[model samples]
Target: MYVGIDHSTTGIKVAAIGDDGELTTAFRIDRRNVETAGAFLEVLDDRIGLSRVSLATVTYAFGNAIDEIEGIEDVPNRGTTDLVGLDYGTGAGATVFDRLYDSAVPTVVLPGVHRGLDTLHAFFRHYSALAGADKVASMRYALERFRAEFDASGAFIWVCASSSCMAGLVCGGRLTGFFHWVGPVHGWPDPEAVRRGVESDFEDVFMRCGLLPRRGADLTDVHDIADRDLLQSVYWSTLMNVYALYPFARDLGADGLDAVVLSGRLMRRERPFPLGRRVYEACVDLAPVRFAEPYTSAQGAALVARDVAAGADEVLGIPVGDVPGGRDR
Candidate 1:
């Protein structure tokens, strides 16, 4: 069995793949309540026998084997980029990694993209996972959807939803070297900020963003304002952040590509909430836009696992198990 874990900003997700490569069991847990390594094993034990499992892969908590994005470097590391190996007791990945190590199970860690310039050239690269955590971004998901419908290939732009939202390019199964930047503290807008443009007051629109504080109130039958103006503000914010990384995309225009896709928790909403819709609509004209729901980084991790287990020469320039680095290049 192959185990894939996504240490996302929201929670820890564990998925087990069957021998035939089908998804077996998947579970999610809050990032905070993890008390010790035993808690992780307990969860795995319930899903499948630990001894039967062979390979386990985790995302976002490990060190960067290839940290730079293909072309951009100004954006600093956020989220797990600063913490490699999950050894820090405070970092969420640390507890998870520690537990996995204690089990004496074979494991592999994923890396994030970083920005750095070539010593000999004026060019820069946004180094990250070969496919950026092996997850589909908005554009990649859209391309899959678009190809299914149109029977054609096209370029795409994607933004992943994790602790920090990262945008990249995807075309012909290859991701972009360029991407935009925004960490939680820097990119996520305050609810009050979303309300500024709407006729509704800040509190009125802030609640509409689907994030609300729990106050132990027996409140039921709430309302979703669906305010047009509030939605537009959120839309603009998403686009601008992505556009901020446009230079990297231009640098990697090796193939003709144009279009956008929306992926992430924001894409999962059934109704095109104001923020989500605006972002989608704004980019629709750029190319035919599409939506891919239930974004799962684990899918990417599983793909990488399959590749590594087969003895890939390189996974984004880092050695995979015993494979020598740069052999794939």
Candidate 2:
């Protein structure tokens, strides 16, 4: 059996893939009450036997270290990137990862895709950063969905928005580039800023920009706002963040992408929510749009675990290495 774990900002997601290569058990552990690795494992053990997990792959916040698939012990900082604004569940992550490491299961950790890490290049790139392997995992599933549903051969774009918005390009099975500058923290870029081609440090922008908080919000106030101006403005900001990557998905005068993967919180398991529905409506005119849930990262991690246990060298084009070749973005 293989195991995939996603230490997302909101929860700890775990899945167990049986020998048949199908996900047999999956569930999300709410981070609200999860304090220790033992508690985390206790919940997971109830769903999928850790003893049955021959090969396990885990993804923690940021995932900036060790670009390729590598053992958890091999990575420093628990696969994080600078640890800036990543205090969501650091202790929980350490506990889960530490327990996983001590387990008999041979576990590997994956790096989030970032600009400095290895990936295909294009005319467009993130200002200085891209995203984590979570986006890449969604793209991997998007590719499968396109092949299975569209029956077409071409590249696609993944527009992921939630606490933040990010875009990734996949062409010919290679991750070409990504856009993280306009993520939620990026808020909506001013028209003059666009005209000026204004640029700034991603961390600074992330701290100050974006239309909404990446995490918790007092939806009560959001629900009580009159005139609806605040909602509309933030809505536009989110749209802008998504559209910023449309051009990067294709070359000039191109027909556009084969499909659009509405990812992150806006979409899930081929399901599209309100924001995701709008993105689909807005982009369907250009090409088919499918909602590929962001949680596929865990599934992708399972795939990684499966393949690695089977002796494969890569997972959906991401290299496997004990150490990454470049610094984390």
Candidate 3:
């Protein structure tokens, strides 16, 4: 079995896949619920039986410390240069990484799209980092789905709007660039919020910059929100983000996107409105649009483990390092 771990903003997601490329099981553990590495490992064992895991691929915050996929034990500081400006989630992901590092699972750590990544366009170097490793994994999964469903591949854009909103461009199956939003609805803070952060502190500002909390909505259940105005704001904000990146995708010389893939928690909601369908309808003029499964990142990471164990030297243009026990087939 191949295992993948996604250390995301809300929780840590684990997914398992068999050698036949079929997902066997998947689950998520909230960041706050993690007490210790050992405790989390015990839970994981109970859920997926770690002893049977052939190899595991893990993603952590930022992923800027390295540029290529590497073994867990070889990565430093859990694959991040610094956590000063990052929103570390109760140290749950860090604990998970430490545990996997010490274990004999032969784990592989994936890198986030940052200025250091050579596959990215030159213009995107303005920011130190673009998206997390989970976003890359999500895009990888989207590309696979696109190829399988459409029987064609060229260029595509991935928009993930849930706790926050982010979009990336993938041309010829490689990540080219990303649109970074600094607004209340995005994970990053806006200029006004940055000024406020400087005035007091950034930690408080970063935590509250997300859309739901900024609009005083409950984060526990987005579908249960009673405020129609807030829902509209979220829908428009997500669409605008996609629209903002459409021109770039067309002008990147890929002759327009083959499709626009949408994912994230908000994409899965269907209460007040079908968020994913609405977004897809709005974007149909730009290109065909589709939705990715909720566990895309974790499942994509599982695919990475499967391919790397099969001797794949690269995934989505990101070079792979020596796998601890990977075969050279």
Candidate 4:
């Protein structure tokens, strides 16, 4: 069995996969459960049975520093030297990475596709510096494994719609470029708040930026776009993410795009908000759009680990490092 770990803004997500990325078991350990490696282990408990994980794929932080997928121990600064660059719950992610690094199981770390490494294109300049690695893992996992799961193939534009909306492309099986847009949901500093010295740190402000927290208890449970103004904003933000990335996708080769994949908490499995559906409807002009399972980064990362363990040099066309004998170099 192989495991994939996604240390994201909220918590540490883990996925155990059988052959060909078939998800066997999955759970999310709260951020509070991962303050330290020992604490993390206690949180994991028997839920994961880490000892059984023959190969583990872990993703952390901007993923900017590391170009290729690498071994956990081999990653630089947990895969990025620029620590203070972006704060998307990175401290928690790093702690989780350290936990995997010290473990007996072989851990493969995936890189965050960015201007720093993937391609120095004008479109992928500064904004992608600290785009979460989980999104990259999701993109690769979606494309590389989409064929098996859906019997679909070819290039596609993937939008990770969450507190933040990030859209990118996989052209010819390669992640070419992307656009990052953070909605008011991820929080932006209110000039008045900053003026009153409310909070200086953007991350702190950004954490409170989501629409759910901004709303009261009554509307908290409301998921419909019609009643909730928050969902309207969210719907607009998500749509813009697709609109922004459509150009990049088209530039890469619109003709090759097989589909547009949306993955995130907003794309609820049970019922998609009408506004969100409308937003995607607009995006259909570019290509047929669909929502993949949420938190696919973990599954994708597991797939990478599985493929690498089988002596594959790449996962979903993303070249991974050669960890000889599954030992850290």
Please report the candidate that would top TM-score against the real structure: 3
With a 3 Å backbone cut-off (N, CA, C), the pairs that clash in candidate 2 are 112-132, 112-133, 113-132, 113-133, 184-210, 185-209, 185-210, 186-210, 187-210
lDDT by residue (tens digit), candidate 1, 117-201: 1210123243332223434222323443455543223345665433334565554445434343332212323545464525544
> What C-alpha lDDT values do all the predictions have?
0.47, 0.61, 0.78, 0.66
User: Residue 192 of candidate 3: its Cα lDDT?
Assistant: 72
Q: Which sections of candidate 3 miss by over 4 Å?
A: 36-38, 149-153, 182-186, 216-225
TM-score each candidate.
Answer: 0.63, 0.76, 0.90, 0.80
Per-model clash counts, in order, read: 22, 9, 0, 3
lDDT of 3 by residue, 229-271 (tens): 6656667877877787777666667777788899888777676
**Off by more than 4 A, model 2:** 36-38, 122-128, 149-153, 182-209, 213-238, 252-255, 268-273, 322-329
Question: What is candidate 3's TM-score against the reference?
Answer: 0.90
User: Candidate 3, which ten residues in sequence have the lowest lDDT sum?
Assistant: 180-189
TM-score of candidate 4 on Cα atoms, chains taken together: 0.80
- Summing lDDT over every window of 10 consecutive residues in candidate 1, give the lowest-scoring window: 213-222
Ranking by TM-score: 3, 4, 2, 1
